[model samples]
Target: MARFYCDACKEEFEHSSPSKKEYTDSFFGCCWQYVAPCPQCGKECTEKKEPQKKKRTSSSGGGCSSGCCGSCSCCG
Candidate 1:
């Protein structure tokens, strides 16, 4: 069994079939690329890795003002 992480649902999942060949042959025949879908959200799951912290930034006055559609340079 191989463990996979789903970013969409933010959950970890496991597949019963260990080998890619067996899993692909049973489900997706002829396709060499095998990506397991998350059972919770049905999105493609990737191999689990260490989570990284996201950097936070404060919004500056240069950003778009209230009621602005953000199509102007101020949005940038």
Candidate 2:
């Protein structure tokens, strides 16, 4: 989990990067979305983070996307 400081809500909470390939539409495109609620204000906020592609060759015969399982470490 990644901690994000929202100036609007004045609170910090865990954040997860959205999966862009999971969505299909003319609006979403290639942009990823982050969904989370503010701890202090209890307001839902959607933050956008561009999808990052990292190339890796694994012996297991599989590919992994950018970031760690679509999650980040909470640095609070």
- What overall lDDT goes with each candidate model? 0.65, 0.53
Candidate 2 lDDT over 1-76, as tens digits, reads: 6555566866666766532233456986655445566767766565534479989643342224333343334311
Q: Clashing pairs in model 2?
A: none
Prediction 1 TM-score vs. true: 0.40
Using all chains and alpha carbons, the TM-scores for the candidates as numbered come to 0.40, 0.33
Model 2: which ten-residue window has the lowest total lDDT? 67-76
Off by over 4 Å in 1: 18-34, 49-76
**Which pairs clash (backbone N, Cα, C closer than 3 Å) in model 1?**
none
Where model 2 places Cα greater than 4 Å from the true spot, the runs are 15-30, 46-76
Return the top candidate by TM-score: 1
Q: RMSD for each model, in Å, please?
A: 10.6, 15.7
Pick the lDDT winner: 1
